[model samples]
Target: MDLTIHQNCPSCGAPIELHEADRLIRCPYCEVKNFMVSRGVLRFVLPDRAPENIERSEMFYAPYLRFKGNIYYCKGKHQKYKVVDTTQQGMNARALPPSLGLRPQAMPVSLVTEEIQGTFLRQTVKAKTLLERAALLTVIDSEKIKAPFYHRAYIGESLSCIYLPLYIKDEILYDAVTNKPLASGGSAENMRKSGSGYHPTWTPHFLATLCPQCGDALTGEHDSLILSCHNCHSSWAEQQGKFHSIDWSCVVSAETSMYYLPFWKIRVRSTAFGLETFADFLRITNQPLVIQEKHTEMDLVFWVPSFKLRPSTFLRMGKNITLRQAKIPDGEPKMVQRMHPVTLQRKEAIQSLKSILAGAALNKKKLLPLLPDLSFQPMSTELIYLPFSDKGHDFVQEQTGISLAKSVLHFGRKL
Candidate 1:
């Protein structure tokens, strides 16, 4: 994983050095912050600014992907099936401590977003691999949704590469950022050992706030995934060092003043499982609903919120929507107010959709036997804006008149 990528500072015309481990770098001459981005997997390191009092201390950035999303687990088969549930989960992206018990918890640290300065430990595990390991720990069988599950599971409204500061002093392990002791003796000694060599590097890319296509300054709420370029009349989703064209449509509402909320409307075709229709779902789940011959093969649609909200609330929203009928109306919205930032991207949404379908299918009938295989093919994806009325501390859905508490919205000023 030793990569020597040479780049120049976007702010100043100065050669920027970059090592494989560095995600954010600063220019020594111009003092500009630059971020390292790539289409492939990327790793980031946090700056260590520990106190100078510790006589013997070693600082290094340990990599971890902060995960936030739902976790589903089930065991047994047919009549013996039991213990099926889906709960929100968060996982630390680090190896479990050895028998010495030097477990370090990642806590909040003031990160230098403007300029990061530190030697990063080469990310021995890729984010994708770490996500897989997390899914395995959760006993999830599918792989396609694992990455998305972890990506969406990030505690905050966004996914981040976290590097914790590990300090060793007198054979005692301490969290340098918090100055809290973690473990002593052999565990501390083991953690102090380092094998990854840091090479001299610099940050290459500048954080762009303008539209890459039209060169117009992008306008949107902070951390929003959807950016609009009025010059080109296009909406783009910023993902993985590139701008992707996203299908955006707003619901037509009669209300004069309304805010358009974004939701990932995903249609998926399930194969390798017999639960393909409403009747099949009812039969498999043993629901009391009467089976009708007209209910044949049907595609599963998921309306996942793009903004951050409580896990329970989000799950409820996903279950309340009806597929196929939730299409976004054609034409531009008169005035769409962007509320919270979109935390989930399209790829992650697809992965999450797969997991959601699998979880629903598996947990539907504990008494039913397990399927031989489970797979999903995405039929269509769109970023649909649903109109909502901001009513003081709550939001009322324009179409359905359903009301939601303001606390459910993770971002934006209190209404």
Candidate 2:
């Protein structure tokens, strides 16, 4: 469902196009990068194909919400992953198609602009509802997996609203893109009352990538969700339409990191479960080592990779980091020249907590019973960048002894 979004560079006023998921806007003309600050859900429109002489007032837009991401679930002892990339009608009116089909994929789209002459139909369907439907549409085959217990999580999701243009001609509703008359949906009147005219409030806006602590420009790749400031030696992530200072750290290692891979260090206060401390985790997971005083004294925190990777690597990487969190010495947070882009947002990382816990547990049958009641009350979170040696085909972190294939990283970017 990813599509190109046309934008004008704030620096040079030169037009630049970026994928819908991209947050960083790099100008080819000016050669300067700026972060795209969006206050609400990103909105894009399908180019219309109404008759050239048609008046602008005859056109109106229908809304569709697209959900793209990965869903991970634990069934008994088996961990499975499902890919979901689907679109649903964003409006309540049944007259319109339930989906735009492959229109969005086949045609070019433009970011909604205030200058548009047509009206935008209000999006009546909540994103949560659409996402639920998408989950159901892409659910893993229940017949194949024989687990009585199941817990699922959605991560790395990209949510956006796309508008389909329609036109009214000769008192008949017509698809603006194809100029085809409506098959069954009644006259244009039904479409008009779908909602109050859609407003520009949902349009994505841009903000300068300036460090709030120090007015220096922040830096990150187009898809990087977390941006770093070299001047302040700190990191910031977009939260609720604004920049929030992220508590981050870097572990010093003998091997210079080719890419300081970022990982989310999250501590959760679980209800109806004894998962609050490292000792509890050790006991529940049936660790080979006998529980000791030091283990009990250590707080339990999960380390989740802040980037996309293969399902196997994702679980292994998170487990390896969590197992060694206590030993991974605290080091100063430094922004390296070649830091890996954080593709996964913090909330998305949190969604995988329960799944990771399930993967780490020794006995799935015992752990599955406690999952429904395991409420993750996040106490605190931090971004920890670990030094990873650049192996020819993969990345190896000596401290954690975790290796990630370069192909996994490359394929994840496309995801």
Query: What's the lDDT for all of these models?
Result: 0.49, 0.79
Looking at model 1, residue 329 earns an lDDT score of 45
Find the candidate with the highest TM-score and give its number: 2
> Tens digits of per-residue lDDT for model 2 on 189-228?
6666553454667666677788999999998888988888
Which stretches in model 1 have alpha-carbon errors above 4 Å?
1-66, 74-161, 164-194, 197-204, 271-300, 323-335, 338-340, 354-363, 366-372, 411-415
* Native-referenced Cα lDDT, model 1: 0.49
- Residue by residue across 368-398, what tens digits does model 1's lDDT show? 2343245557778877778779899988777
10 residues in a row with least lDDT, candidate 1: 78-87
Model 2 stretches astray by more than 4 angstroms: 92-94, 138-140, 144-150, 193-198
Compute the lDDT of residue 367 as modeled in candidate 1.
28
